[model samples]
Target: MGFTDDGDIAAYRRRRSVEFKHGRIAMLATMGFMTPEIIGHWPGYLSPSMGLKFADVPNGLAALNVVPSLGWTQIVIYFGLIEYSGGFEDYRSGTPGDYAWKALTSDDPEDKRRRLNVDLANGRLAMVAIMAILFQNGVAGTTGPEMWIPAL
Candidate 1:
């Protein structure tokens, strides 16, 4: 059966709810604590305070490791690419919680797809930059993506 107007509305609502849930999950993940098991560890009133102590681990430790290995020229290029990719990842992941802050943030499915495409492109570029820098600095050999897959 074809979807009626009500069905479409319901689907839209469901999709929006999923997106908001993802946003919340991202926030919680970034917070470092509040995993289901840990939620009960803190007292009800002091949960926020307790969570703050356990949570708050910084993201992008891999990116941080890339820094010391890059040489002078590679450092500049790698860092620039990393920064760009990081921004793209944040956009695609929607973990920064800035969706409403942007003027043209769209809930359209097509727009979301476009954002994902950008995210993928940026991610690939970032990886390439990292590998090139690493290869130049003798951190990685010339085995290409295959070399990293096994390690992952």
Candidate 2:
């Protein structure tokens, strides 16, 4: 008797799946590991004295380190949950779509969506704030591992 049992729900889920997929791809292209150059440049922009020679580093670990530590912790946590807890199965089984449909069909869908968006925005803002604070507190330096890890 849930949302997934409805025909309209299936169509809605399909549309949402496509939309989420495209949006994820676009976001990854701009902000995720897909664009190592951008990631490398972020730390430098935040604190030039970090001495993170991202360009000279043997591998791309510099960029990777900064991203995972700075602001992508939510993504890491989400991925870890999906990975270790088999949440990916839910995704494959259309649970997220069903949930999305249910949310959209709810009596207060607009309010729910607004709250969710605000939460997301707040999380992003918090990440940026953390990165800025870390940089300001002189926590933005490259360890020697960046240079040697690549050779191994």
Candidate 3:
């Protein structure tokens, strides 16, 4: 939309806003995928408190079966609360991912732009990496998103 039209920087920004949101989500998902493998087992209420030990859990798609219903419910509720509190106005307005943490923000515009570019690049790479991992697991006869597609 922006490429064909001159002086369409706003349109480009609106598209980039969607990219930024996806990038953030992919980054979070990438961390979640790796966290269990890195830590063996979470020390928090997600694992120990649920009577789940490090050995009891499996990595990749198999881990999804190990988690209890309550764990998923708690996660949904927690994130739901955050979403409800913040509302979707930021995303709707094409300015997403601002948690209002001033400490994490930079006073310099150039610095902020640089950091955002880095974040966007990293997130894009993470999205591709995670998708590749999922696809690899799917092809290996593992349980994952591929099961939902009959063609796969």
Question: Which has the greatest TM-score?
Answer: 3
Off by over 4 Å in 3: 1-15, 43-51, 87-104, 141-152
- The sequence of per-residue lDDT tens digits that candidate 2 reaches over residues 1-152 is 45455668656555555444344444443344324433443333333456444454322234455632544677678877865874323244643323354543344757765654544454456555545533543543432344346865
Score residue 88 of candidate 3 by CA lDDT: 43
Poorly placed runs, candidate 1 (over 4 Å) = 1-105, 139-152
- Report how far residue 102 has shifted in candidate 1, in Å: 5.9
Local distance difference test scores for all models: 0.43, 0.46, 0.67
Ten residues in sequence with the least summed lDDT for candidate 3? 94-103
Question: Rank by TM-score, descending?
Answer: 3, 2, 1
Q: How well is each residue in 68-132 modelled by candidate 3, as lDDT tens digits? A: 87877898999889758855444455334443444534567777667777777887998898897
| lDDT for predicted candidate 3 compared with the true structure | 0.67
Task: Give lDDT for model 1.
Answer: 0.43
Q: By summed lDDT, which 10 consecutive residues of candidate 2 come out lowest?
A: 38-47
Rank ordering of all candidates by lDDT, starting from the highest: 3, 2, 1
How well does candidate 2 match the true structure, expressed as C-alpha RMSD? 14.5
